[model samples]
Target: MAEPFSIKNKLTLMTEPAAAGHRMILSGISLRTGGTSRAPFASLNLGLHVGDDRENVVANRRKAAEEIGFSLERWVCAQQVHGTNIARVTGECAGAGATSPDTAVKNVDGLFTTEPDLLLALCFADCVPVYFYSKQPAAVGLMHCGWRGTVRLGAVRMVETMCRTLDLVPEDIYAVIGPAIAGADYEVDQTVIDEVSKLGRGIRNGAVTPHGDEHYLLDLQALNRAVLIRAGVPQEQIQVTGYKTSVFPELFYSYRKDHGRTGRMMGFIGMKNKGEGTS
Candidate 1:
């Protein structure tokens, strides 16, 4: 498993040699980080709707954007509804949801754009953060995939959107499965098991296993990878971090581990300015 380098205090960055110069990151929970939100939603919480102080969330977002060489004005995000809907971001949508939830691209879980300098971001605790980039078109994308989004095949939707809107083919696309709860720490009820089982044999193979009492452990990373492969993304073109949020409290926030009283890490991807170098 490849590790994201910590730029400062637990905030980390994930980059791939294959993606050329695209920037992708998975933030960590660290007190020294820049947000002013208080305990529980402490320090670096980038989520605006998670009961954190609005001012603090904004400050944290500004700091993250600056660190990545993106201005707050160019940061684009969405109101993640845990669905498969994907939005094609453009210059007009830049800065939406960067400071508040109301202005976000409504009810969407995935955001993609070919526009340079537009930073696409999404919040997550245990939900899988899937990233997409294409060298051919110089495009990038980010998706929030929880159990609902996974069963709905959010990755496939993002691929299809990129194909339709950006004329990108799945074979030319590169993807990364960022940190989330691992199978060992994630237990689901029979309802979730049934829904995931409907995804097909390729996805069901090692993705779900029986736990005591009508409950099962689900591997969201594996499930999303399978969906991407089925959508035409080659296996070698994808990267899985394998970093389980539940197992690393000091490094990340986990909704299930903290019983819903927790902050969220940010997953971001964007193309750099034409003359700018990778950070």
Candidate 2:
């Protein structure tokens, strides 16, 4: 397969740009670099709830937005409760959680829209960020899925909402599974395995592998791909990035690797509504 994502630079892995200019949609995940925060949650930490200084986090966000070509004023963030709940927002919902967590979309793990210039963003350390796009309707979606959100059918709901609410056709959609903790670095016990087993034999067989006594390695990206495939998206249309958070400490912040005190990387998807940026 080809590279799952591209970037204007090494700091942000962006989507394919418009052939000549910034007239098209933009989507990408921010690498854990180019920011102002201190260690542990060191530099480029975009999440507000991770105990980083508020000013530093906001400054980091401003830097990210400038680099990503999306204005913070038009960005909508989620509180991300790790549930399957998702919200579809428009331009008016911009900057909801750009600087603070309290104003973000409540309890939603996902966000999507057909609206232009309205960036939907969610933060991650080791959790999965799922991207969905339909060119026909010009729609894009983003979701935050960890173990809890995965088992709760977060991706499935995003697909359903697109088809039902946005009138998109499943076969016409493309999905990109972003970086997260790889199976080799993520070990789980019986309870987690049992929860995954409920997903069905096909996914369980490929996603869960025995690592040791009563322990299994869980592949979150693979699991989300399977879920999207089962939800009617074509398997071939989905692209999974090999970039693993736990494996690449230099490019990403790994929650498991850092032992619960790490920064976050933001995954964003949106179109530019004819603005002063994105050249």
Candidate 3:
């Protein structure tokens, strides 16, 4: 693989390639360096629920849509309650969560669709942006998994749901574990570690490490990867970007690092219109 993601424009970190024909996975994770918001938000805030000015957030979203080549109207968003709830949407659900958070697919952290040209989006600061897709049926999914979502096996749920809905086996799914806080930066108390430990030693062995004083360093990417592997997604097919959002202040906003007052980046995944593209 030759770098699964790259900086495409001022607004997004491109992934998979957006010019590989109709079946290409057209998706991008917004960077915090552009747009109109100021100060705490100071630019590129794709989340409306955050305290940023609505107009500025909308403007930022438009910029992202334009750069990613996905129409703003065809986009579907979720309120992201940090749960494992995944919604399967279609053309009829177009524009569900575009400008307003209220209209976003109510309380879902994950969204998927086999229909083309419909983008599924969610916002993030430090949480994992788990992307899923399968070529045979032409589908894409985006999920928000924080420690809570990960402990609940959100990645496995998404894979299982996609497999069940598409009538395919887990091997058919291709997963991407996008940017998020790295283990060195994500220390959790015993409560969190205890839940994670329940995931079995194989999963916990690579993801959870004692941080001293009852705290533990948790590698969310590894945990999600382990669960996905358990769900039957081939280890080789799954890609972990190794991009840590918390470490890049100029390029990303970290809720934990920023002390809860910061802008959000959009994680968008969608299939482009026919002949309209991604790699």
Query: Which numbered prediction scores highest in TM-score against the true structure?
Result: 3
Whole-structure CA lDDT of model 2: 0.86
TM-score of 2: 0.95
Q: Name the runs in model 1 displaced over 4 angstroms.
A: 1-9, 16-34, 277-279
Candidate 2 regions exceeding 4 Å error are 18-23, 273-279
For each candidate, give its TM-score against the true structure. 0.91, 0.95, 0.96
Report how far off residue 261 is in candidate 3 (Å): 0.5
lDDT against the true structure, each candidate: 0.79, 0.86, 0.87
- Tally clashing residue pairs in candidate 3: 8
lDDT of 2 by residue, 125-190 (tens): 899999888876778889899998898889888999888887777887788899999988899999
Residue pairs whose backbone atoms clash in candidate 3: 16-279, 17-278, 17-279, 18-277, 18-278, 19-278, 20-278, 38-42
* Per-candidate alpha-carbon RMSD to the true structure: 2.8, 2.2, 2.0
| Residue pairs in clash, model 1 | none
Candidate 3 residue lDDT tens string, 1-279: 445678877788978553323566777799998799998997888889889999899998888888887778888999788899999999999988898888899988999998988889899999999999888788899999999999999999999999899997999898888889988999899999889989898889999889789989998988998999998999898888857898888889999999999999989898865665532
In model 3, which runs have C-alpha deviations exceeding 4 angstroms?
A: 18-22, 277-279
